[model samples]
Target: MIDIVLLSLLVVIAIAIIRMKDLFAVVMLTGIYGLLSASFFVAMDAVDVAFTEAAVGAGISTLLMLVVITMTGRKEKSTRHKPLSALFVVMLTGGLLIYGTLDMPYFGSADAPIHKHTSPRYINDSMEEIGIPNIVTSVLASYRAFDTFGEVVVIFTAGIGVLTLLCVARSQKNDEEIDSINDSMHQQHLVIRIVAKMLIPFIFLFALYVQFHGDFGPGGGFQAGVIFASAIILYAMLFGLSTARKVINQTFVQVIAALGVLLYGSVGIVSLMNGGNFLDYNVLSSNPIAGQHLGILLIEWGVGCTVASVMVVIFFNFAGRRAFQQHKKQAQDKESSAC
Candidate 1:
């Protein structure tokens, strides 16, 4: 019953987002959509997925979208193009998806091939094989370790792509323009600042706990990274981008992001050097179980570093561009007034 209500809310939010002309409203609706989806995940007993959705979708992604809208303007331009083609494409895709589902096993069916085959092995043998009681962690960090490495690489590549598109080379600007932008960026709410200052340390401590506690529970590197990034983002919002940049500059972030991918790959290389296949954790130590633990820990740390740095770098680039555009607009206004 609750799942149905959440799904219905999600559908309504999606339609509202489509109909809304205000970009700000659309961004807010999107956050609402993420929250509803996270709730649905919770109803389905996927707490880890719900955690991710809440953090990335509802929190970080919404913040980024809001930042982008600041520069692009709050109102969407009217489109002259007809929607018939788009409607057709959506309907066609939906029909195909429904058709594909016709061949799938009934929900939670014991006879489902996935349940009959691979699920049993992971559930039955993960403890002895991977030395982790958490089946999901064991499968993701051990059995499917290569795929996780690929995911990290993909995230690293995405961060590089965002930088390529948004980051500008050093250009000369007058001190007045710099000062104007800096002055405008500072938040005036002392209460918010004080509260955030008190919370940031606890947020980081929780991130570390999630990173190291994944072997035994529902938290992991991805969640930890996003949580950590959120703390930095909050600081940037409350204090100023300049302050955040001073704490961890874009160049440093880029370096850390790349290093994370390299670190994960290096673990694989070490495994190979120790006479095991790539990403085989057994060779990391004489005790196979200990090696598995060590390998998962290192890889998870690499993942956390890459994800946190990439998110922060992306946020910085967006915020920086917005500031630049605002400053340019202000200068143009001043010149026109002088003329």
Candidate 2:
């Protein structure tokens, strides 16, 4: 009974998302839909899945779409599509879902086929096999660590891709153009600047906690990385780009980014030197428990540092050029007026 109501709500929201006229409004609705879906998943006992959807689906995707909108322009063209084609695609997807649902297990039944096969092994052996209390953590960080590492690499690649696309200084003309755009905001928002100054330190502290807290809770390198980067971005937005640059020098940001990966890689090298497998943490400290904790902590810190630095670097490289150009134009305008 509850399932039907929730599924109906999802379908209604999905339709609304498509039909919304305003681009920003549609984007926001999509985020709301994602949050609702995450909540529903949590109600269904899929906590980990809900966490990821809440974080990535609602949070990251919305933020990124907003970024893209800002970089391009505020408005979106009303894209006209053939109604028949849209209907065909919808029908095809719905048919597949309907077919798949026929084979799905009954909910909340202890003797379900899925529980009989997979859950028993993990339920029985997880504690003895892995030291971690959280089965998901053990699965992610130990058993399928290669996949986690790849996910990190993929995230790194995404930042790199954004850097390549937006951060890299393409042409002198483009630089000049960016500077021109930046000049429009010469009169700064004093309130936001003061507020950001007050908040940055606390944000950094929170990021550190999130980085190191994964052993007991649902956080790790990835969450820490995003959190740290966001703090820097807030600083950049509140203060002028040049002032922000003064605080986090371009050279310094680059060095820190490079150092982060090197720190991570160096851990593995150290493990190898200690006559252990790559990234094996037993040899990091005299006590294996202490070593494991230290190793994970260090890697999380490295990830946070890199993510934060890289995000700010992207903002600066792409947007800073515009600000610089704007300042130069403003200065020239004043000089000409005085003369």
Candidate 3:
């Protein structure tokens, strides 16, 4: 019943997002949709997935969209409705997707091929093989560590791509303008600043807990990294971007992001050096189980570092771009006034 209700809400939110022209409201609704989706994931007993959706989908994603809106403006440009054409494409796509699923086994069917072939092995032997209570972690960190490494590389590449495309050249004048803007925000929100300052520490602590506790609980590097990035985001929001940048040097953050991918790859290379398959943690130490534990721990750290740094880098670039644009506009206005 709860799942049904949540699904209904998700549908409604999706339609609402499609119809809405106010970009800010749409961003907010998108965040709400993410939260609802997270709730549904929880209902489906996928708590780890839920944690990620809540952090990335609802939290960091929303903040990033909001930052983007600062430059893009609040309202969407109106476009002529193409209802018939859009509807036709949507219907065709939906039909094909549904048709594709027609021959699949029923959801959670015990007789499914996956259950017979793959899941049983993981379910029955993963504890003994990987020696971790959380089968999900074992599968992710050990069984499919290469895939996870690829995912980290993808994220790292995306951060580099965004930086290349959107990064502005910083100057002394731009920095002053950014500082002034932050000062204005800082002075206006005394209570928020105090409350956020209090919460930021706890948030960081929780992120670290999630980072290290995934072996036993419903959290891991990806989720923890987002949560950590979110704290920095919150600090920037309350204290100002200039101050945040001062504390977290952009050059250092970029280096850390690269280091994370290197760290994950290094583990795989080391495994090969040990005469084991790439990312095969069994050979990292004399005791296979101990090696598995160490490898998982290291790779999870790599994931955490990369994810957190990329998120911060993206936010910093967006916020800095906004500041630069604002400064340019101000200069233009001053010239016009002088004329």
Candidate 4:
């Protein structure tokens, strides 16, 4: 019953997002949708997935969308042309998805291929093989380590792509103009600043707890990384981007992001050197179980580093561009006033 309610709310939110002309409200509604999805995941007993959806989807993605809407206008422009082709495409895709679902096995069917094949091994053998109580952690960190590595690489590539496209060269402006622009961008919400400063330490602590406790609990690197990034983003919002940049510069972020991928690859390479296949953690230590534990820890750390750095880098680039544009507009206004 709760799931049905949440799903209905999600549908309503989706429709509202589509119909809303205000981009800011649409972004807020999208966050609401993410929260609802996370709630649904929790109800389905997928707590790890819920954690990720809440942190990344509802938290970081919403913040990014807000930044984007600030750069572009808040109001979506009206268009006269009908989106007939787009509507047709959407309808066709929806129909195909519904058709595909017809052939799928019922949820939790005993005859399902997943239950018959790898699921039994992961459930029964994971503790003996990987020495991890959490089968999800064992599967993600050991059974599918290569796939996780590829995901990390994809995130790194995406961050690089965004930086390449949006990290434009700053216009040559005098110190006075730059300082004035920075001053203007600085937020003056004293209450927010106090609350954020108080919460930031606890947030970082929780992120660390999530990062290290994944083997026993429903949290892991991906979720932890987004939580950490959210703290930084909140700091940037309350304090100012310049101050945040001073704390962790863009150059350092880029280097850390690269290092994370290198660290994951290095673990695999080391495993290969130890007479094992790539990502085979059994060879990392004298005790195979110990080796497995070590490998999972290292890989999870690498994933967290890459994800956190990439998120911060993307945010910095967007904030920088916004500042530059605002400065240019202010300069133009000043010139017009002089004329």
lDDT of 1 by residue, 1-339 (tens): 898899888888889988999999999999989988998998988888898899999999999999988877899888999899999999999999999999999876778888777888898988998888778788887899999999999999999899899885545464346545666655458787898899999999999998889889888889999999999999888777766777877798889998889989999999999999999999999999999999999999899999999999999888877767766788899999999
How far is 337's C-alpha from truth in model 4 (Å)? 2.9
Q: Sorted on lDDT, highest at the top, how do the candidates line up?
A: 3, 4, 1, 2
Model 4, 1-339: lDDT tens digits are 898899999999988988999999999998999999999999988999999999988998999999999988899898899999999999999999999999999975789876787789899999999998878889999999999999999999999999998886654453346556556656457777888899999999999999999999998888888899889999887667776777887899899999989999999999999999999999999999999999999999999999999999999899888877877798899999999
Model 1 clash pairs are none
Q: Positional deviation of 206 in candidate 1, in angstroms?
A: 0.9
- The number of the candidate with the highest TM-score is 3
- By lDDT, who's the top model here? 3
User: How many backbone collisions does model 4 have?
Assistant: 0
Global CA lDDT computed for model 1: 0.88
| Per-candidate alpha-carbon RMSD to the true structure | 1.9, 4.9, 1.4, 2.0
Candidate 3's error at 15, in angstroms?
A: 1.0
Full-model lDDT for every candidate: 0.88, 0.68, 0.92, 0.90
Per-residue error (Å), model 4, residue 300: 0.7
Worst 10 residues of 2 by lDDT: 178-187
Q: Write the residue-wise lDDT of candidate 3 on 58-135 in tens digits.
A: 998899899898888899887887578989999999999999999999876778887688788899999889998888
Clashing pairs in 3: none
Clashing pairs in 2: 178-322, 179-322, 179-325, 179-326
